[model samples]
Target: PPRVRECVGPPLSAMAVQSTPVMLGAAGLCFYAASRTFTSPLVPSAAGAVPTPHLRAGSAAISADAPSTFSGVVPAVGLLAAAAAVAGGRAATSTTMRRAAKVKKKGVRVVEGKEIPWNIFSPKAPYEGKVIANHKHPHTLTEDTGDANWETSHVTFDHGGKVPYIEGQSIGVIAPGPDKKGETPAKIRLYSIASSAVGDNETSKTVSLCVKRVVEVDGKHANREVGEDKPDKAGTHFPDSKVYRGVCSNHICDVNVGDDVLITGPTGAEMLLPEDPEANIIMLATGTG
Candidate 1:
């Protein structure tokens, strides 16, 4: 990456004898080289000329003290083109960032006078809920689960009436232990609550989540060390790729009847049901909304 300067060439006065067409062609090449090579155009000093860069790697830079003649115009035009290119690129980038910043979060709906339970348990303080039921949904069931195309589960947890949530709200699930980065208490993953405030058992003491086991190839952890674990386990290996299982979703799906899970928040007010009984509701969702 070290810049190697070439020896200084002859004065532009001597080159002025060249044909006008030849001088113009050289000026065009100069413009293209300057625009492609540098973000800041090279400026000729009051007493000296601009550096004419050679396109190839390690090619020496030639300096010419451009006189007040036709030959002097080559480097001058190139300098202007380079500066314009850099300025235009920066302006486009600024416009893109401004457009992205304009996007806003969805507004929370207020139906006359309905109280919204927003963040009863936060990420800082989470609720411990026990698993009441974890079963495969009938829609995702296959004759041979070993080669099942897709696996989705309906997992219910016992909140002990402490964590109350309305229908259409979501709860955050924190996977047990240090994550792949060795950070203790992995980050929370939110899933929509599939049950109403009274719950599936109608006791108002439980909450449920619909989760799909996520299995896919991940190139991010390709260089990570995979343990000598079974293929059915988390770090399943492939011949030329790395297969990853979802940390939180897999944990929730694999949990047994009595396993305790860290739960946070009956959060999100945007999806709350309108209080009006006769209000028309049209829901359209895919996968696990």
Candidate 2:
């Protein structure tokens, strides 16, 4: 049978192009030294000897008539070059991705001599705040508009001297489990802090939020018959989707003085007060903002 020669030049060259400089240098040196040994007059190739198919690393094939010393060296060098090429390729890809993507700031940051916390309590691990006070504001509406009138409440939560917050910062409220889609521990809702650093009662062990109960009729069920509405096992009636309640806002507004609420972070720095005591700030707000 006639001897067959296989070439792996294309794939190996592509790999070399994608590999890092160190890997390319190492592979080049190995091949260069091996080429010198193969071309030397001192080495001889046995012609007409029974050809034995030999496969080396990187899918390269070498003639079996080559000297035994060179045969062993080729595969060893091939393995080293192949390994280096793979590792260098991966490293190059990773570096390119990092260079092209923007990295988010991590860890704590200091501002105005005060250390600010970032992601201290994430959604996965939120802090438990106790409802200390939940009261409806009497001056929310002055008109005779019944359901149309705004219903706002000032709610306070006891942090037990654990959660420290400044004015303009916001706390994320995670409503109780099993949402409409049966998803446990519903999504988080961020509400602005309504109190200063000293808190509503002048103590730092608490945080407060001004929330307005969201009540809107869903147009989807507006065409349904009046008698079609039914009540769940909890005795809560679904009246033609009559009331689409805001999960977090309604939960906080309806809480008693001892219920526990899931809280995440006292985050936000854009609206922080200036360090100067005489900064003279202007006040402008509307609705439950």
Candidate 3:
């Protein structure tokens, strides 16, 4: 009998191992062909054909070293483009973070030409502003303990387009003439700003204050001297008392439209509005704060 060989299939793992190398070889050949096609010069239509003198003269000579040069240069160009894209992305991210930091530091949204004014007019050299309007509220309460009939006034001043202020800041009002202490120049009283940066009428030239007349009764007063205080017939300790008005409050409240008043300072930074539009704000105020 002739020698017989048994037919047996190779194991699955062995088949996979054999196929992998073949596939790898095919892939490598394909990659090399693709690279050569990209980086190598165009081949002439006919092989072993000599170029005519006129054709050679008209066309630039192809250098033998050019294909190697292109192979290196193409990868370098691609890498440069990728680097630039990454750098641009990082720069954009950095800029966004810087803007956010600025907003957080300011605590308020920034408005165009609306920064908190510092000493626009100092107490020494106060701005002489004309009272544009002094409107009285119908029912207003004073900060004093007494339930006195006190009035709140919305006093607007025209600074001839010089004074600029934002909301939540304060300005100083110099009460004319001598103080109660007999000082020659009256002291400057700071009042919270009630209007927006653009004044009452949206003009960039004016500012307004909400002032409540300060008044005190005999019972609330610390001093026991010099006031007509009469007890009720029932001998109750509470008594009818006199009302003493504040010099600055009275001056501001009594001011009429077109009257000139001395003003100083557009100060205070703690109450300034934040620059971010989406920021949450909570305000706690009482009695013309």
Please tell me which predicted candidate would have the highest TM-score against the true structure: 2
Total colliding residue pairs, candidate 1: 0
Query: Candidate 3's residue-wise lDDT over 168-262, tens digit each?
Result: 68889999846667665689999988778888777778887777765556545422234543332112222344444466876777777788899
Weakest ten-residue segment in model 1 by summed lDDT: 134-143
- Compare candidates 1 and 3 on lDDT and give the better one: 1
> For model 2, what is the C-alpha lDDT against the true structure?
0.66
In candidate 3, stretches whose alpha carbon ends up further than 4 angstroms from where it belongs are: 1-115, 134-146, 219-242
Q: Is candidate 1 or candidate 3 better by TM-score?
A: 1
In order, candidate lDDTs are 0.65, 0.66, 0.63
| Collision count of model 2 | 0
Model 1 agreement with the true structure over 27-103: per-residue lDDT tens digits: 67676655544433343444565566543444343335423233445566666566555655565566568769787
Q: RMSD, model 2, all Cα superposed?
A: 12.9
* TM-scores, each model vs. reference: 0.52, 0.53, 0.50
Error (Å) of candidate 3 at residue 148 is 1.8
Task: State the lDDT of candidate 2 residue by residue for 152-244, as single tens digits.
Answer: 767788888777777767889999945555567888888888878878777788888877766555544232244454432123344645555
Ranking by lDDT: 2, 1, 3
